[model samples]
Target: MFIAGDGAGIGGAKAAALAGKIAALDIACDLDRLTAGDRNAAARPLRRRLVKERAARPFIDSAYPPYAAALAPQDATIVCRCEEVTAGDIRHMAGLGCLGPNQTKAFGRAGMGPCQGRYCGLTVTHLLSEANGLSPDQTGHYRIRPPIKPVTLAEIAAMAAPEAIEKSKRSNVSTQVNG
Candidate 1:
């Protein structure tokens, strides 16, 4: 499987778009939709653009490093606001031999909140890394669990009902016609 954008470590919209294009070209070549030569020809420009987009990251990082407060928050400071997990709590987990963010969940529910680690994943990783004397790579990220919203029984029933299906089709047609 081809991973692109932030998953591939290339951030920013333009860079992600370029990465996506490159992946698409490679996938097309693999599927024989395009020859290897054609794929390379198409990807050359995308790679150049991706490089240019990534080049600015160093300057931006140097210009504006992470906030010290975020990197080293007070013990009482809530790092994972959704779960109300404190920086000190994460440190305590590390002291207890919690090696990574995933382990932190068992210790204090740090990455088990509604956001599922989107907001606090990096901070938790950093805290664990620092406390355990491990690199961020070694103090790995959360094993993501997708957030599930509470669904009502009526919602489930509506999904399978023929009347609901007919209503949905009519609504779609109305929206299309009105637009």
Candidate 2:
């Protein structure tokens, strides 16, 4: 049975677990020929255990990607709101021999993703640097912007008129300070 997951390999885990159950039922779970056209073949006992065993690590590790590979470089988008950039745009710019974080930001908007590149900046820099054959450090720092998320005009107005809004800056500051 096919399963979908967060792309962290959860599907492989589930397949392993299911294979365990199938092994218990069928008593034959050989996995030797389980690849490619072998999936349609009868389950062998050893194959079931192997499937379960093989699936465990991927399942557990599926929680997150390796540090070396943050998101699926190709699959993951490159736009950074903090930088306001997209991956494709970054690649295109990189192809033009652009380098450095500041340069990348200026050209590709690396730190402009919706999460302000808090989620994607470093990873993007790494990928871009690798593609460009530049040192990661050369990928200059991204622009540090305020209010990463979009604050509506109404919200700004409320903040401006704290007395009218009742949630004054003092209260906000006090909450933050106290917390």
- The numbered model that scores best in TM-score is 1
lDDT for residue 29 in candidate 1, whole number 0-100: 93
TM-score of each: 0.73, 0.37
For model 2, where is the 10-residue window of minimal lDDT? Answer: 1-10
Best by lDDT: 1
Lowest lDDT 10-mer window, candidate 1? Answer: 141-150
Q: What is the C-alpha RMSD of each candidate to the true structure, in Å?
A: 7.3, 17.3
Residue 109 in candidate 1, Cα distance off native in Å: 1.8
RMSD of 2: 17.3
Which tens-of-lDDT digit does each residue in 1-179 have in candidate 2?
22223222344555556555544434322435344334435445545654565665765677765565452255336456465456666777778877755676566556645555666667667766877877678765456465446889998886768575566667888999999
User: Tens digit of lDDT per residue, candidate 1, span 61-111?
Assistant: 889888867987889999998999999999999999899998888888888
